[model samples]
Target: MRHAVTLLCLLVLAACARVPGPFEHDPSRDYYARPRTDKAEVAISPPRNMPPQMGQRVAATLAMELQSYGIVATVAPADAPIQVDGVMSTRDADLSIEVQVDWRVVGRPRTDEPATVKTRARPEDYAEQSERLISRMAQQAAPRVATLVGKPPNFIPRAPGQVAAGITIPYEFPSDPAADGTAAAAAAAAATGTTPTTAPVPTKPAEQQIKVLVAPVTGAPSDGNRQLYSGMRRALGSSKIVIVDGAGEDVFTVVGAVNLTPIDDRTGKLVVKWVLKDPAGKIVGDIEQSNPVPLAAARGSWAGFGDIVASAASEGVLELLEKAINRPR
Candidate 1:
């Protein structure tokens, strides 16, 4: 009788847990089933509740996997062809964690159903399993994505210096340094039928403003970091940028990773890599800025480090502004 009672309890516990399964689909919505143009790029958002570094690793891994199939991909910030977002949930069972990631294409009527992974709750296990699952998904999805956004549209050949409107060549960053800066200039000039003499000079450019949320700096001395954070806020505010609590339409987020390496007893080099992402989780721009600082000043005991961060913030904001100008509409 006792054995029977224990079995009943175990059954009840198992019933209480929510088992993982494939994503649900609405049959009426066949948007994803329909053929479409190939996306030029893909941006993957990190899974929630994971360490930032780990999440980035997953995205980067997925990006590489997609690239192998001839698709351009990155962890979010710059405007891209598609966006990927995901969530992770835990259940009472030891191996009941579930993760799902969805792919969204701009102007598309339907989003691709999410690919998911279910595994034991161990953090390390989750990471490894999720990586494999994501890699597999990327490989499976790439051929379809490539086919959809298949070919560059046909256009009449023009003179060497001639420009054409409504025509674009999909470009990815960090591939060619010179081309990276030219994508925007080329877009702006495409409307005017004139070859850009230099990187685009915005004529009558609108006051470019975006709402931004700045995440706390990592790997910096706390006391000095607070001062630097405040100084950065002030500098960005003066540039006519509005700081926001969350992402929304016309909103962006700024995140950073900082490393302070001591060069001597008192002086050190602070390396800051800042990334800016638009509301869709597209990377807009990034800046890797470094400055020398005195240890005392870096700990907020002196103002020297604050000044340096303030200047760096201004420059970072300027880069975002340029990205905004060049970003696809």
Candidate 2:
């Protein structure tokens, strides 16, 4: 009876066992996605109230030291979102040169406390020891500056089939007096039954065109300012908008500002803001383009790349112009 019971128990266990085939996965969970740990980027402006060469060295050293803490830092202008500005001063007393640097972070809702670093060197050794002092100051200020920034927000790709509505501006061609004179001569010939030397000019109603003057771009590195300026003109030329050389009573002005922030040694974030103004200098609207680009591309010549950027941004620019045109003056 005990053997019979044992056999029955074994049969019951076998029946309860699950057959293994393939492991089931939840479709809702991403199996291949990794956690994002991207850190914020910081910009270090050249130190003020100091010699130009020394200021440059200090800024460069500070950037390098900040990178040691896993922070991507670059020497850039004041337009960057997280900027570190330093005012340096030197004092000579008792045959010794004392160097002091006050570092401040500029940002919204600023929470970082300003840091100051000071070092002294003998008058004879000031030149040779300046570098060491600068490096030391950088090391001390980097940690405090690092606390001022955090992980940057993730970038989301735009959806497909996204496009702005087309805007039309009213344009009238300038009257041509020479063409008018030719027409008069032709008409006289026709009436007097004599052949005219020049052919008659055909007259038609003035067609629509919008004249826009693209101002030189600001805050771009290398030759990017000029490249973007010409590129914007080229992009606008394709539409009904006429690119003008200068601002006039009938012309609209487009001003651009480019801010490049290094995200890493290899990559950077470029933000281009285009502001449109009417002939009277009244603000129309602004369009912005932000994207991640290679650091080399951002810092180096924009050359062929500027055209691509302008083309991508032209649509929004045109849309803004359209809105301004439709708006009641």
Candidate 3:
């Protein structure tokens, strides 16, 4: 009798922990999660509970798998051919659902199987199974996705971090080197016509007036880093990258601590550290931006600590811009 009671209690707990099953999301109503493609022109919001990578790994694997099946497809934020959206859930089975994939160019409706698959397992076993099944199903649907894209199915399995890797944090006041004192001097000379001094101009235009989010985790935001945040915001905004109303929309949420500890000077990069968080305050990206700051770096040199910080931060910031630009719409 005691044994029977224990079994009942266990079953009750198991039932209480049930997750949603397949077909749970209503794509007809847009009540679904989306794909994670670094190539997406805009980042769709992630579901409330899952990590960013969870969606990315699954999306990439799914896209690759769908491609194998000859479906005409592309990842979401795709203004391309067909946009394949995904919905994931688990219960008696682990299910990664396409919910519904929309086509920018309509295709022949299916008289055949709907896009779905399910693998039954314990709660702990669901995540892996769901990923694999989603991948397999996506592979099965590639032909359709390809067709929707009006191409011979060219689907690239984007590696994880490709999106995040593109996010960068800059550390320069005059992100546009053209805005430096030399440029100022040139402008002054051009205005005053005082023996017009000649200063070589940099050909590459810097991103300006692009309002960026600075989530610093370093010991302190170096002067260069602060300048970068200020300058890049200005440059990107003025660079015609966004509409006036859309200015400051591009944001990178930093997370983690930027370790500034250098084992040695000169050989040691300035101690820099930080990470990024999503708008919901979830951390998705991290990095340490520091290069060897020579002891002599104190003596103003061309490659001083300030210069190095700006360079490192600029690299990080540029990456962020790339990610922002590429995120799915």
Candidate 4:
């Protein structure tokens, strides 16, 4: 009897097995299928009165795949999640069951970036394709969540003797504030009482070797161009940036140029072509890359050139260092 029942089940499957060929939508031939996902926690909701079987199957597979990729999904009883029904459409040809199942993955967006889940595919392509789609969706979504919640702590970076703007900072200048003051009153007071007047030495400005010659930048704005390197160092939490003056023992040098490029007919951004040259002026490293910056909507400003240059320089140096350190021996 069990053998007969097994034979009957086989016959049923054989009958249902479509002879692969071009199959069109047949409203009269439509049949309701069962939910594919059998797991109790995943809630699979299908489009209303259409057919839940195909959708349920698709949804279950999707939920399972999402779960595999670290998303939480569950299969539960009917009347579960009441999301809008997704439309399932199909076009079939010999050896193919081209099914488009449009449904939402079980949760919110990646990066908290909202996305409306719409999926289409060949259902006959084995369960892997659907699961693969779910995997991809979840993979994409995870980063967005991480980004929204994983921002690093705020750090108040300060220069070697510099203080942040709003707070009182302990300044560590020379101990002799009385006579070292550049003001005329302090100078005259020292000179008044035979106060062993020795010309006070001027403390040197803090210097970090730029170790590079990025630009002579001889166009409309020169000093502004130089400020790019200066500003970048500040942003990178490094005061070690020094402007090259041709007399540093650090023989390694990175020379570069920033060009303005047209993003579209009306706008442009900066690009840098950098060369790393040894003391003998032989180029060791050469490359070209773009630097993206936020442009102010104001019609004429370089349109926010100051912030762009600073950001560009910071990124370029950071890239150079990362490459330099990570290069295989």
Would you give me the overall lDDT of model 3? 0.35
CA lDDT of each candidate? Answer: 0.47, 0.59, 0.35, 0.36
- Report the lDDT tens digits of candidate 4 across residue range 181-291: 545555676779634444666665543323543333322122233333333323333323433324344544655455655566533454545455544565555545443
The sequence of per-residue lDDT tens digits that candidate 3 reaches over residues 1-329 is: 00000122212322442312211223432313434322333112222234465555445544532322223233455564344443444443223222222222324355533333332232432344343233323333334433434434322222111111112112122245655757688788879988656667675664443334443223332223332332222223222222121113344444323233444643233444444444445444444543333222211111122223333444554555556546685
How do the predictions measure up, each by TM-score? Answer: 0.34, 0.38, 0.25, 0.28
Tens-place lDDT digits, model 2, residues 1-329: 00000122212222333311111122322224433213336789877987787677668766754543445577876345587787778887545576666677765544655566665555554575343345445544555565545532111112110010011111223577668878789899999999888655666766655878888789987556765765676567556465555578878898989898887776666778888888899887777776665554455445445655666677777887787777886
Q: Could you give me the TM-score of model 2 versus the true structure?
A: 0.38
Candidate 1 residues 179-251, lDDT tens each? 6567767887898888887744334434444566666656765334443444454455435465543467767
Per-model clash counts, in order, read 12, 1, 71, 18
> Which portions of model 2 show Cα errors greater than 4 Å?
1-205
* Ranking 1 against 3 by lDDT, winner: 1
Best by TM-score: 2
